[model samples]
Target: MPQAQQLDPDTFAVRHRIVLVTAWLQVPFLVAVALLTTGLGQAELGTIGAVAVVALGATVTQSIRARAVLASVALFAASAVLIYLSGGTIEAHLHIFAMLPFVALYQDWRPLVASVGFVVVHHVGVSVLDPEGAFNHHAAQHKPLLWALIHAGAVLVTVVGLLALWKVLEDASRATVAALEQVEAERRRRLEDAERFGAELAREAARLVDVSGRVGEVAGVVRETQEASSQRVGELSRRAVDASRAGEETRERVGSGVATMGDLEQRSGEVESLIVLISEIAERTKLLALNATIEASRAGEAGRGFAVVADEVRNLAAQSADAVDRIRETLVAIRQGTTTTAEVLDQVEAAVDGIQTVQAEVVAVAGEEAAAGEVLAAQVHELTTLAGSLSGAAGTMSELAASGR
Candidate 1:
């Protein structure tokens, strides 16, 4: 299809056709006017017919713009000449109105003025050439020169009026054409702007879509990470509980060892006391033997044999007491050793209990940390997904915008 601007050539061609058709239409009017006028016989009709045919031929052979002026001039000259030869008549003068519209279309006022002048001159020429017909002698000469002049003036004014009306119509047409062109230009500009904006929107949409996709991808990763972290945390929590239980068992074992050591220390102290009692009994026996020996000595020789027996008994008692004293010392040393061992075991047990407590605390902390990590991972995943979704939406928008462009 031809664009609106490109239609101008076609429009001009159509207008030319219309002008040709209008000019052709004037031929019949010319013939009729000739028939109804004075001094216009078959000869005048034939002459006008030939001229009209030639004008139509010229219009068909050439372009409208080229032939319209020629036709108007030729027609005007012929009419004037015929009127001069016929000595003018009302029918001849009135027929010139038909060509006025074509003259206006030609956009050349000269042709219209010439045609009008031709008619006016015909009036004056008729009065000079044939006074009877020019002054309306057929009406009993009742119309005077003033009346004839007034009649000519009326024709002149009518022609002028036609020219004015034609000019106004042409100006209106031009204005309408200009306004249409402006409207078309504005419409084209708006279309371009709309396309540009649509492309921009599509790009934005595409960007959003890309972002959303990335977010979705990130979300997926985060989800996976979160699940893994949760599993790990749960495992760590169980492990930590196991560690705490192990620590408690170790503490209990240490406690049991400490109790056993305390019992051993108590048994050692009892043995030390038994050794001290044996030593005291041996010392009293020795003192009693010594007193008996002294009494026997005062009785002289009879007591000699008794003193030997007492001395032997005294030596045995002294040996027995020394043995008890050494045993007591050994028992005291054993009790001290047992007490030291119990104190060392107690310290070890306390240290083991402390290590177990620390291990339990570490396990508890690990569990908490693992749980926290899982939560953080979940949140990160969600955020990444959201960002990806936003990007995706942007990308889609961009595509849509691009398509619009």
Candidate 2:
């Protein structure tokens, strides 16, 4: 979660190391300043220089910039004060040169100026105590003037160079701030555009919802109409089938009657022939009776019994004749019935043929109806598949919309 501005302890330590390295490099410079201006004993100079080096080492290790600067300045100021209070010699003024390099070690101008002031004060104090040995001692100290000029020039150049570096660093910091601000502004603009797009998507989704509702209503209405039409067609077909069946039954009954009439007509012809044969048998019986009467008269006393037999034969012949007359009357009725049946049979046969034709037509109509139904079913199945495909497409769109959201 750390951003670009976040500084870790290691990074901070590394920056401090840079400052420490710069401070360490100035140790030689401090020794040079002491050797160049001071003619003190080697032991004292070496002791003071060793102490200065120890102070620089402590300052570099401290890691606190302000503390490091102040400590460095204090060490050099103490050395100058010590040298000045010990003797009224120009050699003690050499410690003043340590201030310039020490100032260069710090980033802040306050610490640098403070350290420079300390060095200046040390120089003033030395001049007051030993005016003849000071760099401005009657303006005739050639070696001190030369050393002063060199130190002053070096100080001026260090201050100017540090100030210039500070200016460049300040400019770069300002540019970094400006660029960060611009990036934040662009990010805000993009967020606003995303919000606008979300609002538009919501409106479009609402519109699609309304359209789906209307389409569902329309589909329901169409389904109802289709069902009603199918029911009506079914009813019409059933009625046609019932009428056809009735006609077929009527025709079958009529044909059966025609066959029965034909049989009755043939039976009537047989009855007529039997009636004529019975009449011939009656005539033969009458003749046999007459012959028996004549034979009885010739037999005298025996003829009486024969005469009785003759009378019985005549009675039997009369009964047979009555029976034949009744049969003849029954045959006449049968003949009349046959004639009527024949006429009805002809009508029945015509009706049967018409019924059969109607049955054929009904079968054809049923076949056509079935074929039409099959076609309609096929169309309905295709539409159902299409609807399923459309539903799948809608589902995909919904998933896409959800993902986008």
lDDT on C-alpha atoms for all candidate structures: 0.66, 0.61
Q: Output the lDDT of residue 129, model 1.
A: 53
> If scored against the real structure, what TM-score would every candidate get?
0.58, 0.43
**Residue-wise lDDT of candidate 1 within 319-345, one digit each (tens)?**
988888788777778777777877887
Best candidate (score: lDDT): 1
- TM-score of structure candidate 2: 0.43
Off by over 4 Å in 2: 1-260, 283-303, 339-351
**Candidate 2 lDDT, 1-405, residue by residue in tens:** 111232246654564455445445545554555556554567546656665655565565554555545555655545564453444344544554544554444445555666666555545554455544445444534444455455456655666776676566556766887888888888788666656665555555555555555555555565555566566666756866776777677767776777787777777778788878888988898889989988998898989898899989988999999999988887888788788877877877787677668766766776676667667656665555555555555555555455554
Residue 204 displacement (Å), model 2: 7.5
Kindly provide the TM-score of model 1 when superposed on the true structure, using C-alpha atoms: 0.58
